[model samples]
Target: GAGVSQTPSNKVTEKGKYVELRCDPISGHTALYWYRQSLGQGPEFLIYFQGTGAADDSGLPNDRFFAVRPEGSVSTLKIQRTERGDSAVYLCASSVQGARRTEAFFGQGTRLTVV
Candidate 1:
């Protein structure tokens, strides 16, 4: 795809259910990121993947959240035991891995509603 693509733009899951959000980054981009945004807050970094390995995952809230980029191209965020507080927009972004100044391109985001 020309730009970041996220599947299931909108998702509604019941509490205690599990959900998986997919992200297809721009072609050739090696730096991929996953973030979550609540109502009025800015996107909170969840994890960052450089190529096929996760470079940084410090922002992941707990063991229930995880992200992976097995092929260095597409990524997926997995959530377990979804809670009401987990309802938010999950955003995916990508940029050149080591360019001096590469701007990240973001997807429209997947709005996950946990009810």
Candidate 2:
């Protein structure tokens, strides 16, 4: 079974530009999540999709961030007007069916640098 995978292991962009981060979850997994990890901090949950719908998106910082899981397999996180403050490692995770004590497997992540 393929594990989670992310694109653009490193992304460099000027402030105010838009960037899209991609995530491919493991096959047969029904739960997918997106998180942001700042230096020295734990990964903060951004959004979660159960199958094809966003089960929880309250963690999304603001309107600047958005995500979509159309086919229940892959997900994409979009950030508008990138900022230096937004610079961090974007992580994607996947689980089996529920979050009940089930750990999520994370990707290598995309290290976005807004310069």
Candidate 3:
């Protein structure tokens, strides 16, 4: 019954700092996704997880971005050496099953501001 949840609704960090954003998906959902949204723009797909494995990680801009869902439930997005350009709203979503047809519910998002 619960929806996707993201922590630290807002984050402020220096250009070279590291940041870890957390997400908790709905119960029994088999598919999870991460997206980034810039000012006035649509959310961009980042990585997707089906069960405990990453199904698609191509959207990650570079090696500095990564995510993990070890036990197939909660996931964490890790950014190494954060840049000012990395500032954006990080959103998480989950679906009842892994399919293009199923609807995915989104979290409020963690807004990261790199100074």
Candidate 4:
């Protein structure tokens, strides 16, 4: 894909259900990140992956939220025991790994609604 691609732009599930959100980053990008945005707020970092390993996942709220990037090209965010408070837009961004700052391209995001 030429840009970051997120599947199922909108997802609605009952409380306690499990959901998996997918993100396909731009080809050749070596860095990927997952973020969450609640209503009226900027995107909050959830996780960051460098290559196939997660370099930073401390931003994830709890054990219920997890993310993985197996091949370094695509990533999946898994949410367990979903709650209404978890409802938010999940954003994915990717950038080239470099010592200098690189621009990141973001996907439109997947809106998860816990009802």
Number of the predicted model whose TM-score against the real structure is largest: 3
lDDT of 4 by residue, 1-115 (tens): 7789998899999999999999999899999999999999999999999999999998999999999888878899999999999999999999987234789889999999999
The C-alpha TM-scores of every prediction are 0.96, 0.95, 0.98, 0.96
Q: Any residue pairs clashing in model 1, and if so which?
A: none
**Cα lDDT over the full model 3:** 0.96
Candidate 4 minimal-lDDT segment of 10 residues: 96-105
What ranges in model 3 sit over 4 Å off? Answer: none
Alpha carbon lDDT of each predicted model: 0.94, 0.94, 0.96, 0.94
Q: Candidate 1: global Cα-lDDT?
A: 0.94
Tell me the number of clashing residue pairs for each predicted model. 0, 0, 0, 0
lDDT string for model 2 (21-68, tens) is: 999998888999999999999999999999999999999999999999
lDDT of 1 by residue, 1-115 (tens): 7899999899999999999999999999999999999999999999989899988899999999988889899899999999999999999999987354779899999999999
Best by lDDT: 3
| Candidate 4 or 1, higher TM-score | 4
What TM-score does prediction 4 earn?
A: 0.96
Candidate 3 Cα deviation (angstroms), residue 101: 1.1
Q: Show model 1 residue runs off by greater than 4 Å.
A: 98-100
What is the clash tally of candidate 2? 0
